[model samples]
Target: SDPKAEYIGTEPWTPKEALEGGEITDKADIFAYGLTLWEMMSLAMPHLELLEGEDDEKEVEEDEDQSLEVSFDEDAYYDRLGTRPAVDLEALGNSYRRMVELFYLCTEGDPVRRPSAAQILQALESNVPLNINPSEVIVID
Candidate 1:
């Protein structure tokens, strides 16, 4: 695990209400785990926007303050688009991609909608669908 993984629990993944002076909870930890899981699976890709057109040089501006920052774009995240990195479902294959879906459940915009850590563990233990035929699995684009 990356040493900075601890930061996930405190910032953008820390739920909007918490940032607005609400009490933090175990749910925050679950959110962090979801994010860490995505990083682990995707080999730590930057959580940035897709480059427009053919200009491979297009880049999301970096924060000069920190060299190794994960995106903390809470606004775009709550709006459900720009902030998060894109996952290539076809490349990840079915099982790994399903694990990525778990991140969405853990990081739902509404805290109440996010799953508890126990629920996440139970789901993981119960579901072992990775070995299924890739052609038959329908991944969300």
Candidate 2:
């Protein structure tokens, strides 16, 4: 089963090509890495922790509707043209926030738009803080 369907929604971590049943590439791993990086920075919340343990048939149905609604909202907010993650700005500070922007690039809706793992590694190696303007900051996925 496509776990994204039952749980996490079509998050930035999910490759758009995979969702469309197209041929996926190493970029898919990069997409997942963006999400994992967010989770690691955001206190390690389990993927789809909100919908855990609703295995009963009845519960599943009920949860599905609610999940879809939440998923939709999340999708809108976390999308490339929408918002970003819900990390603690005060705690993470500006540098980490800039990194979030880079992660966002990794999760681009078009697989081709996403940065490769090697590019991401090079960016990380530069050791330069992203320094995104706070006014342009968006919400979390």
Candidate 3:
């Protein structure tokens, strides 16, 4: 009767703490919102890379008219800590730096460091830059 067992295969939008069976908070929503923003900007599914290198094998199997059942390795995928979808900041252009920073702030690995919904709204409304350090920006294009 483990509480965390139910969360083993949660989606990529889930925050690290949730995946680790930690307490859920409002910041979890912020983490999900950050992934949503990444999805919108990248026009790609989050954590699709988890299936990387398997596509070719599946294609070959399909071409042979064989029954192909692909299974997602959730344990392997979730074991890699701090794995977030890459955001193509360069493709997004220079105009979106602040927004990108906000995305990073929202998805911070430590929930305690994540900005509250109110802080995010205030930054968006006033166009004020976040005080996050550059080293903290882990999402790479």
Candidate 4:
């Protein structure tokens, strides 16, 4: 399944829960971005720890209403990637830093506050001056 296509919601909700119904908005996409960034840095997802046990052949044979796994709020992607080595992000240089920052900005909590894809693309296209090398900020366990 496409990770981004996954739904996230529950009723009688905890603070951690979100309303799963209705539209897939840019906010949803931004949340996905935050999840993605955490994945990139942690070399895994925020909470999930194991690879998915089932496959396409063993796909859940339930409708949305009948499905329990339909809206898992956990960070399953980090588990899917398995063990990964630490990355010294500082080594990426200034250009790479800009790119990662773009990822973070794209994933900001407020969808309205995050930059649009067009803005991101424009930033990438624009010739901006750099001071610090982006490749130095490292990420580890």
Candidate 5:
């Protein structure tokens, strides 16, 4: 509830104030949704280490280089979000594919290309599952 408070879990948790509902899309859910994509791809909840009494500012130290970006190896499937996550893609339906694609799309570097919540919901309904076997999800974490 405090802006100064640190964010904890791997998945974003929206507050009641965040969902007042006037806006078409909420950034809070979008963040969680992005993590969900990584979750579905990596097959695990994106984990963030619990802070151990350090100030929130002190706990986060992001690399300044533009090249130091977040990327998945897409080869080693052992971990996602710093945790082991494997999904049974073969078990998922066609619709699931399109949803993941949309997740990745919404998480694009260019936010303009990302779809709004309403649009995301609409797009996911199409459900054109990807041919990539969820079980073969290899990634280098």
Candidate 6:
């Protein structure tokens, strides 16, 4: 891990490598960028839907002298589940499908599997399909 590459962002935006205290690389940036794009398209905070669902399951008690306490292990959640922010590519429209595809590539659990900034740019510019197996191309009839 690079000493200077510490990430201080919120849990939802942090990558698996960063969550595991592993070496932070540009791939971490790609992970955060993907979530940011999701936020922009959905007009909502990342992981908010999941959190809200969890919130509904818990009961809160109000008291004049009592304080509310909340505890959540974001790192543990990622370590155990390897979950990503939910996205509906179909709802985002055809223009955004390409970007959503890139989002999945950027957030890959294996940092090495994630695409580099150059590759992402090239795919975007060339309108090439971004897939794990490049040999497998989808041909729409």
- Runs off by more than 4 Å, candidate 1: 1-13, 45-54, 58-85, 128-141
Let me know the TM-score candidate 2 reaches against the reference structure. Answer: 0.51
lDDT of all predictions: 0.54, 0.54, 0.68, 0.43, 0.43, 0.68
lDDT of 3 by residue, 1-141 (tens): 344433333477888877777766666777888888787778766775434454555322343557674555577666643456678877999987887888888888877678777778878899986554333322211
The sequence of per-residue lDDT tens digits that candidate 1 reaches over residues 1-141 is: 232223234443455544554444455565567667767777753343444335645445557876644334455544542123456788888877667788666655555556765567767898743221213221111
TM-score of each model, paired residue for residue: 0.55, 0.51, 0.66, 0.37, 0.36, 0.64
Residue 18 lDDT (model 4): 25
Q: Say which prediction, candidate 1 or candidate 4, comes out ahead on TM-score.
A: 1
Q: What is the lDDT of residue 82 in candidate 1?
A: 16
Ten residues in a row with the worst lDDT in model 1? 132-141
Off by over 4 Å in 3: 1-10, 50-76, 80-82, 131-141
The residue-by-residue lDDT of candidate 4 on 109-131, one tens digit each, is 33455554455556668845322
Indicate the TM-score of model 3.
0.66
Q: Local error of candidate 1 at 38, Å?
A: 1.3
- What is the model-wide C-alpha lDDT for candidate 2? 0.54
Residue pairs with backbone atoms closer than 3 Å in model 3 (clashes): none
- Please report how far candidate 6 places residue 114 from its true position, in Å: 0.7
Cα RMSDs of all predictions? 11.4, 11.9, 7.5, 13.9, 16.4, 8.3
lDDT of 5 by residue, 1-141 (tens): 334334333323232223332222233445456657756665544443333334543243358664433433343422222222234557765757755565555454333344556566655576543232223221111
